[model samples]
Target chain A: MERPAYRARVERILEHSADTRSLFLRTVTGRMPFYSPGMFISVKIPLPEELRIRPYTIATSPEDGEPFELIFNLVPNGRGAAWMFERKVGDLLDFTGPFGAFTLERAPDRETVFIAEGTAVAPIRPMLRRALSQPCSHSVHFIYAAAKPERLLYRAEFESLAVTNSRFRFEPLIVQGKELYESLSDEVARRWVHGDGERRRDFFLCGIGSGVLKLRDLLRGAGYERRAIHYERW
Target chain B: MARIRVIYENGSPERTIEFDPAAAPFQHDGQPGSVLDVLLGHGIHLEHACGGNCACTTCHVIVKQGINSLSEATEQEEDMLDRAPGLTPTSRLGCQAVIEDADADIVIVVPRYTINQVSESR
Candidate 1:
């Protein structure tokens, strides 16, 4: 990964929810590397008295170089998210090059399965956008998992994608909130059904800590080899 | 005087150090200034994902012992805690947690998630 030359400048801050906020960082120059839509970037912020780095998925398309967008859900009592919420309209954030390799395949594309929980939807949405724009040869299945309906994001947008392709499948699994650790485990078991795995499909998962773990275990048990699985955990 | 013991993630033995109690309390200001300053002062190499600010949680740590003795978690510290994996009651933003007392002994456990996630992502 080459060093990212152009840093992202905060163009505006939009609060999607009480805790979640989207920081729109517009590229000052057109020279930034063209990022894979589904990839994520590292953010460096200056706290009132300190410096911190956090990673968030690139939510906007690369075509929107007018302003690159990164999305983050504040962990109720998180450090980076909290400090990030304090960002003003004109702060500059340091980011390395687009690092994760979670982009859509360039070859004979097989089925695509995207599993998202909580704020994990941010990264997956970009991939979905890519799939929708160019129309890949293979089918795409987008699964969104959250603790409850109230917590799910981009539902309307993803549902719209389904309209574009009947072959596209969208499964929204709502995990009961609270006792969150156990709820996540149960949610994964429910989403990772037997037939769903081992098929010729590429799986992508994002979400909270436990959700990622549950997804990992489910994939490992469902006959999917580890090498085939590509993922990024925030 | 307050005493503190730091154990690195690399299989190194713990080192004991003392500080003057008259100095400011061990409170992290949620910025890149102090914790990194102190660690760098002690010649300890700590990783800051965003150079010490609250942008990332790469500096996450478990307050295995003496957490109660440290300063309270401010809104900034709590915010950064949100994205960290392996959430626990003992977790604190290492970048935010500071050692005030020169005589206080605290132990912190650095989880594999902090190092692992950043490495894999990069």
Candidate 2:
């Protein structure tokens, strides 16, 4: 609990979906903490009687420079969601972090699979970029899921990256209702289950608890080593 | 009521607090009456990056005494705990170890080193 909490102002906001948004924050006081691509920031929301702390992943990379970005959904009756959705330009909020161990290998020796469902793309986006960046030779596949075609957050960027970067592959899946987890599991199986075992693969999963855990188990059942998978769930 | 003694890693004075297990969930982050919930309720901050979802091992604590009074670790908790530093047979994630016995006396030690990459404040 020794990390200093710094204040930042909301510089801009981009609406990705009806309920999802990406907020750009610029520090108002001390310098920004150096962070890895997959790290997160903890925001403290002051309630009437106590302060509630919530963690949000930094969507932008440290190499991209400030102001860093955070994407989130407006959950009905969620205290953290309400506080985040209410912010305006110039409004200040407190955050402490750049914390998380969910990062990629500096030089991957195998195919890196990045999976995201809903707003989980926030962390996966930067990871995909880092893996595909120059001097790092590795195949990186991104499987993004949304309820509908319109809800695919950062689809344009992913698609563009796929087109221009040979090492990057993007697949967007539209999942609705109860079949969300099933669709993702089936997709993973279809793409990876029968593939040759000679090529080693590593997985990075970020999403809701159900989807992340489902994928984790699927990979585990497939004989993937526990160390080969990394994830973050909310 | 149960007595909980917490020994710090940074040379801070050890603290002992009392609470009724029946009145659980003193804090919003971990399980009700869990080590994380109880400690945070008494103005002690234990790092929990995933907010006690058992996703991260930041809230790790070693049960120096009364390990039997805490709940058994789930499979998922065990998987994540494997990644924790300074792990021990009595190690438990503060958020997942619920105090099952109301009058149980437990002592825990916050390890000096942790693998959680984030620094935090209240």
Best by lDDT: 2
Expressed as tens digits, the lDDT of each residue in A104-162 for candidate 1 is 53422676677777777777877776666655677777767767686778788777778
The parts of candidate 1 lying over 4 Å away from their true place are A1-5, A105-108, A132-137, A177-193, A196-198, B1-122
How accurate locally is residue A121 in candidate 2, as Cα lDDT from 0 to 100?
87
Please give, for residues A93-147, the per-residue lDDT of candidate 2 as tens digits: 9987766667663646678898888788888888887787765577888888878
Global lDDT of model 1: 0.63
Candidate 1's displacement at residue A117, Å, is 1.0
DockQ of 2: 0.42
Model 2 docking grade:
acceptable
In angstroms, give how far residue A132 of model 2 lies from its true place.
Answer: 0.5
- The whole-model C-alpha lDDT of candidate 2 against the native structure comes to 0.83
Residue B16 alpha-carbon offset, candidate 1, angstroms: 18
Considering every candidate listed, which one attains the maximal TM-score? Answer: 2
The clash count for each model shown is 38, 0
